[model samples]
Target: MNDLDIRCAAPSDIAAVLRFWREAAEGTSITDDHEGVARLISRDPEALLLAEQDGRITGTVIAGYDGWRCSAYRLAVHPDRRRQGIATALMDAAERRFLALGGRRIDAMVLESNERAHRTWGSAGYHREGHWRRWVKSVRP
Candidate 1:
């Protein structure tokens, strides 16, 4: 097992980042949502992070940090790389980056069907303070 190289993703890393997103998580909106990603990165570069090993992408997470609280969201580890502490490592960096940016609290919203995510977040020191059945109506034409 080659040691993984964890770092902040740049515009040059988009292809690898998108590849990981596709192969890592299929059902979730992470991979297929590249346009959204472009917008986010354009808005804030630190939102998307990647972990690579031997130059091969292994893990990824999407985070957003405003002036207020840090938002850790859309975490994913390549299918072949799951359970290797990749996700945790990514989260560690993310939290640190957020703190460095003067963020106060960290928050995330996990889907109710995603039990594995719930457990992962909990194990990663996150707790459920509340829940919401959010309603959204997209005005797509």
Candidate 2:
């Protein structure tokens, strides 16, 4: 297992986890959706798994299960930790959880421009589902 431990994230992990979400990769801080994260964890602790190695979260994935659609969202690995099997391990753990939750179909929405991420998910057995045009309307106007 590459000496990495996958486990459920606890309330105490909020700080370090947020840091990794914020500062890990350049231009990758688009993942700093903290309020969204808090809601997801509060709703489904099993959906948010942490990869701990030597006392640090090297990776994380927010797995969400809905009645009709189940998804693994915002799957991320610390920039320096990329290509180290961390992402794969995280996805495996999340998929297993999704299945246990009685999810039949799992989906991942990757930014089309991110070739590496596209390749990773593709190799991990997720194919191109379809193209989506995402229009985000800010709540605070």
**Top TM-score hit:** 2
> What tens digits encode model 1's per-residue C-alpha lDDT throughout 3-51?
8777777777776677776677635553255676677778888788888
Scored against the true structure, residue 17 in model 2 reaches a CA lDDT of: 80
lDDT values of the candidates?
0.77, 0.78
Clashing pairs in 1: none
In lDDT terms, how accurate is model 1? Answer: 0.77
Model 1 Cα shift for residue 38 (angstroms): 1.9
Q: Estimate each model's TM-score.
A: 0.83, 0.84
Q: Which lDDT value does model 1 have at 84?
A: 84
lDDT of 2 by residue, 1-141 (tens): 667999987777877888887765223434356665676678887778889788888898878888677887767888888999999999988888888888899877677788888889989998885665656645642
Listed per candidate, the RMSD to the true structure in angstroms reads 2.5, 2.5
The global Cα lDDT (0 to 1) of model 2 is 0.78
